[model samples]
Target chain A: MLTEILHTLPQVLLDGLTLGAVYAIVALGYTMVYGILELINFAHGEIFMTGAFIGTAIFLTMTGLGVMSAMPALLALILVLVVTSVLTGVLGMGIERVAYRPLRKAPKLITLITAIGVSFLLQDLVRFIAELKKGNYIITGPSLFTNQVTVEASSLFSTFNNAQLKSSSIILIVTAIIMMFALDFFINRTKWGMAMRAVAQDRETAALMSVNVNKVISLTFFVGSALGGATGVLFAVQYGTIDPYIGFILGLKAFTAAVLGGIGNIRGAMFGGVLLGLLEMFAAANLSILSGGVLGGEYKDVFAFAILILVLIFKPEGIFGKAVTEKV
Target chain B: MNLLEVRNISLAFGGVKALNDVSFTIRKGEIFSLIGPNGAGKTSMLNCISGLYRPTEGSISFEGADITGMKPFKRAGLGIARAFQNIELFSHLTVLDNLMLGRHTKMKTGVLAGGFYWGRAQKEEIEHRKAVERVIDFLEIEDIRNIPVGRLAYGLKKRVEVGRALAMEPKLLLLDEPMAGMNAEEKEDMARFILDIHEEMGSTVVLIEHDMGVVMDLSDSVAVLDFGKLIGKGTPQEVQENPDVIKAYLGEEQFI
Candidate 1:
C-alpha cells in the first residue's frame, strides 16, 4: 500500500488539479455575486448544470446537422464553449433580473429563501425539459472528444518519467488558469471592474462616482454565470455525462470552496478550490495506506467536508480571506 | 451664467421638512459655501444638488440644462462630483483605485474592451492613471496611494475622498463637510486644497462646512440654512453680521 501510494502521487496531483480547475471556475460565480450583492445566489449551481445541458444540446444539434463530423475538433469545441458560455451568461442575467433584482433591498433572509427557491426551480425546469426530450429524467451529454487522450508525462516533465498525463486534464488546467488571470485583470484593472469593486464596497459611493449600480450588478451576474457555464461545458467534456442533479452536489462543494477561500475574495476562491481539490484527491487516494486499510475510498466525499470543518473551526475567515473587522 | 441654479427646492421625510423653499445659485468659478448649524438642512440641500434625494418640489439646473429629474449617475456624468460628509470612500480599495473610480464618467471603455485589458483598454487605463496620479500628487497623498483607504487615518481618508472627487474633473464640485473631523493642521491643508481647486483647477465649488473660521476665510459667498429654511445669504462678512444667522446659532430655539 505504501509503495502504491508513492507511485500514484503524481497522478493524484494531476487529477486534483483537473477537478480543482472546475471547482475554482464554479466558485467564482458564488464569490463574485456575494462580493457585489452579499447574496449567496444558491441557483448558481443550477446555472452550472444548465451550462452543461446547453453545451450538450448544442453538440447534439451540431452532430445532427453533420457539422461536427466536418469541422476541426478544436474549432467545434471552441464554438461549443463560446455558445454555451454566452447562453449561460444570458440566462444568468435573466435569473438576476427576475429572481434577485426585486429583492435587492429586501431583508437578507428573504433574499436567501428566494435563492433556494430559484435553485430548486431551475433544477426542476431542467428536469422537465429533459423529461420532454428523452421521456426520462437523466440526460447524458454527447461525447465531444475522446474520454482519455494520453500524453507521456516524461516528454514534458522530467520528474514524471513514468506517468502518462491525460490531455483533457491539461486542457482543463490551462483553461482554468487563463480564465482566472482574465478575471483578476478584469476586476483589478478595468473601468467596469473598478465600478464592480466600488459597488461591492459601497453602492451609494459607486453611484456618486457615475457607476450605474443596477447595470454593474447585472454585468456581474452575466460575467460570473458565463464563467460557470464555461466550467460546465468543460466538466461535461471531461466526465462525458451530466444530468439535472449534477449541479446539486457540485454547486454545494463549489460554494464550500468559496467559503473555504473566504467568500468575497476572488483569489481566495481559486486558492480554496485548488486546496480543497488536492486534499480530497490525496485523502481518497491514500486512505488505505494512511488509515491502515480501515477507511476505504467510499468515504472520499467526506474528506473534503471534514477538512473544511477542521480548517474553518480554526480560521473562520477562510485560508485566503482576510479577517474583517466590523466597523461601528 | 450660474454653473448651478437651485430654485425653490424643498425636501421632506414624512412630516420632517429637511429643506423648505431653499433657493440658491452657484456662479461659475466661485467658492460657494453652505453653512448652518446641525440639522440645519445643509446636507439635505447638498443631497438634493447631488441627486441623492429628489426635491419634494422645485428645479435644479446646471449649465442651462434641467437636471431635477436626472439620476445621480447622470448628474455625475454632467460633471457634478461630490465628497461625502461621512467619508464615503471605497474603504477596501487603494487610494489610486478610489480616485480612478471618480474618473468613471470620463472613461469610454466598455465591458469587452475592459475585460481584454489590451489595446484600447490599456491605453485608456494609462490615461486615467495619469489623471489619478495628478490628483494624488495635488492632495499630497502619493505616499498612501497604494494603501487601502480603510487603514488610513481620518485626515488622510478625507483627503482621499476629496482627491477622488477631483479625479472626476468636475465643472461643479460639491463638497460636504470636507474638513469636518480634521485637526487644525489638517483643516489648514484642506482649506489650501479647496482654494487651489477653485483658483488653480478652475472648478466651480459648492461646499458645506461647520468650521466658522474655515468658512469665513474660504467662501466667496455663504448661504445659511436653519431648520430647513434659508435664513442668511451673502459674503462672509455680511452673513456673519446677519441678524437671523446670529439668532439661529445663538438663539434659545430648541435643537431639532
Candidate 2:
C-alpha cells in the first residue's frame, strides 16, 4: 500500500487541483454575494445547478443540429459556458429581487431562511423542467473531448505508468485559472469593482459618493451568479454527468470553501476552495493508510465538513480572513 | 442667483421639531456657516439639503431647480458633495480608491468595459486617476496615498474625507463639522484648505461648525438656529451684533 501510494501521489494531487478549481470558482459566487449584502445566498447552489442543466440542454441541442462536430468542440464549450453564465446571472439577479431585496432591512435570520427556501425552489424547479422535457429527472451532459487525447505527456515526478497526465484535467485546470485571473483583475482594477468594494465596506457612503447603490448590488449578483454558471459547465465537462440534485452537496462544500477561505474576502474564497479540494482528495486517497485502515475513502465527504467545523471552532475567520473589530 | 435655496424647510419627528420654518439663500462664491448648540438642528438642516432626510414641509432648490424630491445619489450627480461629521470613509479601501469613488459620476465605464480594461476603458481610468492625483496633491495627502483610510490618524482621515468630496469637483460642497475633533494645528490646516477650496476651486461652501473662531473668521454669511427657528442671518459682524444670536449662544441668564 505504501509503494502504491508513493506511485500515485502526483496523480492524486492533479485530481485534487481539478476538483479544487471548481470549488474555488463556485466559492467566488458565495463570497462575492456575502461581501456585498452580508447574506448567505443559499439558493446560489441551485443557480449553479441551473447552469449545468443549461449546459446539458445546449450540448444536446448542438449534437442534434450536427454542430457538435461542425466546429471545434472547444468553441461549443465556450458558447455553453458564456450562455449559461449570462442566463444564470440574470436568474441570480431575479432571485435577489424576489427573495432577498425585500428582506434587506429585515432580520438576518429571515433572509437566511428565505435563502434556504429559494434553494429548494430552484432545485424543484429544475427537476420539474427536466421531468417535463426528458421524462426523467436524471440528465447526462453531452460528451465532448472526453475520449480525445489532447496531450500525452510522460510523468516526470514518478517513474510509474499510472502517472501519465490526462488532457481533461489539463483543460479543467487551465480554464479555471483563466477565469480566476479575470475575476481577480475585475474586482481589483475596474471602477465598478472599486464601487463593489466600497459598497461592501459601507453601502450608505458609497451611495453618497454617487455609486447608485442598487445598481452596484445588482451587478454583484450578475457577476457572481455568472461565475457560478461557468462553474456548472466546468463541472459538467469534467464529471460527464449532472443532475438537479448535484448542486446540493457540492454547494454546501463550496459554501464551506468560502467560509473556509474567509466568507467576505474574494481571494480568500479561491484559496479556501483549492485548499478544501486538496484536503478532501488527500484524505480520501491516503487516510486509510495513514490511519492504519481505521478510516477509508467512504469518509472522504466527512473530512471536508470536519475541516469546516474545526475552522469555525478554532478560527471562525478562516485562513485569509482578517478579524475585524466592529466599531460601536 | 442663489446657489442653494432652502425655503420654509420644516422637519419634525412626531411632536419634536428638528427644524421649523427655516428659510435661507446661499449666494454663489460665498462661505455660509450654520451654527447652533447640540440638538439645535444644524446637522438636520444639512441632511435635508443632501437628501438624507425628507423634510415634513417646504421645498429645496438648487440652481433654481426644485430638488426636494431628488434621491441622495442623484443629488450627488448634480455636483453636490458632502464630508461627514463622523468621518464616513470607506475604511477598508485605500485613500486613492476612496477619492476615486468621489468621481463616481464622472466615470462612465460599464461592467463590460471594466472587465476588458483596455482601449477606451484604460484611457478613461488614466484620466480619472489624474483627477484623483490632483486632489491628492491639493490636500497634501501624498505621504499616505496608498494606506487604508481605517489605519490613518483621525486628522488625516478627516482630510481624506474632505479630499473625497473635492474629487467630485462639486459646485456645492457641504462640509459637516470637518474640523470637529481636530487639534489646534489640525484646525489651522483644515481652515487653510477650506479657504483655498473656496478661492481656487470656486466651490460654494456650506459648513456646520462648533468652533466659533473658525466659524466667524471663515464665513462670509452666518445663520443661527435656536430651538429649530432661524433667529439670525447676515454678515459675520452683523450676526455677532444681533441680540438674538448673542442670546442663543450665551444663554438667557447671561443676557439677563
Candidate 3:
C-alpha cells in the first residue's frame, strides 16, 4: 500500500502544480485590485469566464472557416487573448465607473452587494448570448493539447504523464509570472506606478501631493481586469470547456486564495494560490483512506473551505501579509 | 512677480463656506505662512492651492499658467507639492520608498523596461535611490532608512512626510500644520529642518501653523484668516498689531 501511494505522489504533485498555477493567476487579479481600491471585485470570476468563451468562440470560428492550420490557429489564439483582455479590462473599468464609483463612499456592504449584482448581470448576459448563438448553455472549448507526451523518470520518483499536464497550464504560469513582473516594474519603476503606490498608501495625501486619484483608481481596475481576462483564457484552454457560469466557484476560490495570502498583498496572493492548490489535491488523494467514502474524490472543495476557515481563524493576515494598525 | 497666485478662491461645503474669496501670492524663495484660529480655513486654502479641492469660484495660476481645474497629478507635474497636517507616510513602505514616490513625476523609464529591471530601468532606479538617499541623509533619518514608516514614532513619521514632499523638488511647497502635535523639542527640530529646506533648496514654502511662536520667527510674511475671510496680511509684527486679527483670536474664549 505504501508503494502504491508513493507511485501516485509524482502525478499528484504535477496535478497540484498545474492547478495552483491557474489559481495563482486568477488570485493576482483579486489581490492587485484589492490592494489599490480595497474592494473585493466579486465580478472578477465572470470576467474570467468571459475571456474563456471569447477565446473558444474565436477558435471555433477559425476552425469553421477551414483555418485549422497551426499558424492560423495560433494567430487566432493571440487575437482572442488581446480581444478578451481588452474587453474584460474595459468591463472592469465600466463596473467601476457605473457601479462602484458612485457607491465608493457608501457602506462596504452596499459596495459588496453592487459587486454581486454586477456578477449576476454578467453571468446572465453571457447565458443569454450563448443561447442566442448556439441554443445551448454549454460551450465546448478547443483542445489544444490532445497528444500524450510521456517523460520517463528514475524509479525513486513516480512516473510522470506530461500529456495530463495541459500546455495551457505552462503557458498560464509563464504569462502570470510575466504579468506580475510587469506589474511590479510598473508599480516600482514608472511614474504611474509610484502614483499608484502613493494613492494606495494614502489617498488624501497622494492628492495633496498632486497625484491624480481617479486616474490611479481607473488604472487599477484596468490592470486587474486584464489579468482576469488572461486567466480566463487559460482556464478554458486547460479544461477544454467554457460555460456562462464557470466563474462562480472559481471566483470564490481565487478570493479565498487572495485572503489566504493576505488580501492586499500581491506576492502573498501568488503564494496563497499555490498553497491552496496543493492542499486541495492532497486532501482529495488522501482523505479517502480514512473514510473509505465519497469524501476523497469530489469533496476537495469542502476541504479547501475548511482550510480557509482554519487559516482565517489562526493567521488572518495570511502567510506573507502584514497586519495594519491605524494611528488614530 | 509672484511665482504662485491664488485669485478670489472660495470653497463651501453644503451651506458653510470654508474659504471665501481668499487670495494670496507667494514669490520664489519666500517662506509664506497662513495663520488663523481653528476653522479659519488655513488648511482649506492650502488644499485649494495644491489642487485637492476645486475652488467654488476663482482660479489659481502657477508659473504664469492657469491651473485652476487641472488634476492634482498634473499640478504636481507642474511642480506643486505638499505635506499633510496628519503624517501621511506610506506606513508599509520604507522611508526611502516614500521619498522615491515623491520623485515619481520625474522618472522617464518605460513600464516594459522597468518591469524587467533592464538597463535604463536599473540606471533610473539607482539614480532615484541616490537622490532619495540624499533627502534621507539631509533629514537625518538614515538610521531608520529601511524600517517601515509605520514603525516610526510620530516625530519621525512627520519628518518622513516632509522628506517625501521634498523629494518632489517642487517649485512651490504647501505644508499644512507641519508642527501640529509635536513636543517643544520636536517642534524646534522641525523648525530647523524647515529653515534648512528654505535656505538650501530655495523652493517657495507656504505653510499653515497654529504655533504663533514658530510662525513669528520663521515667516517672511504672514496671512491671517478668520471664518474663511482674510483678516490680515503682513509681517508678523504688523499682523499681530492688527485689531481685526487680535479680535479674531481674543474674542473666542477658546483661544486661551
Highest-scoring model, DockQ = 1
lDDT of 3 by residue, A51-135 (tens): 7787788778877876766465456666778888888888888889999999989988999899999999999999999999999
- TM-scores of the candidates are 0.94, 0.96, 0.88
Query: Per-prediction DockQ, in order?
Result: 0.86, 0.82, 0.49
Candidate 2: residue B124 Cα off by (Å): 0.9
lDDT of 2 by residue, A195-314 (tens): 999999888778789888888899999998999998888888888888889999999999999999999999999999999998888888888988889999889899999999999999
Which runs of model 3 end up more than 4 angstroms from their true locations?
A1-5, A65-83, A151-154, A157-168, A181-185, A188-190, A294-296, A326-328, B7-10, B14-17, B56-59, B63-69, B108-134, B181-189, B247-256
Clashes of each: 0, 0, 2
Cα-lDDT of candidate 2: 0.90
lDDT of 1 by residue, A211-316 (tens): 9999999999999999999898888878887889889888988888998999999999998888878877888888878898899877778887887787778988
Q: Model 1 compared with the native: what TM-score?
A: 0.94
lDDT of 2 by residue, B15-55 (tens): 99999999999999999999988888999999999888999
Task: Give the higher-lDDT candidate: 2 or 3.
Answer: 2
What does candidate 1's lDDT look like per residue over B48-134, in tens digits? 888899999999999999999999998999999999989898888899989999999999988897888889888998998999998
> Positional deviation of A44 in candidate 1, in angstroms?
0.7
| lDDT of every model, 2 decimals | 0.88, 0.90, 0.82
List chain B TM-scores, each candidate. Answer: 0.97, 0.97, 0.97
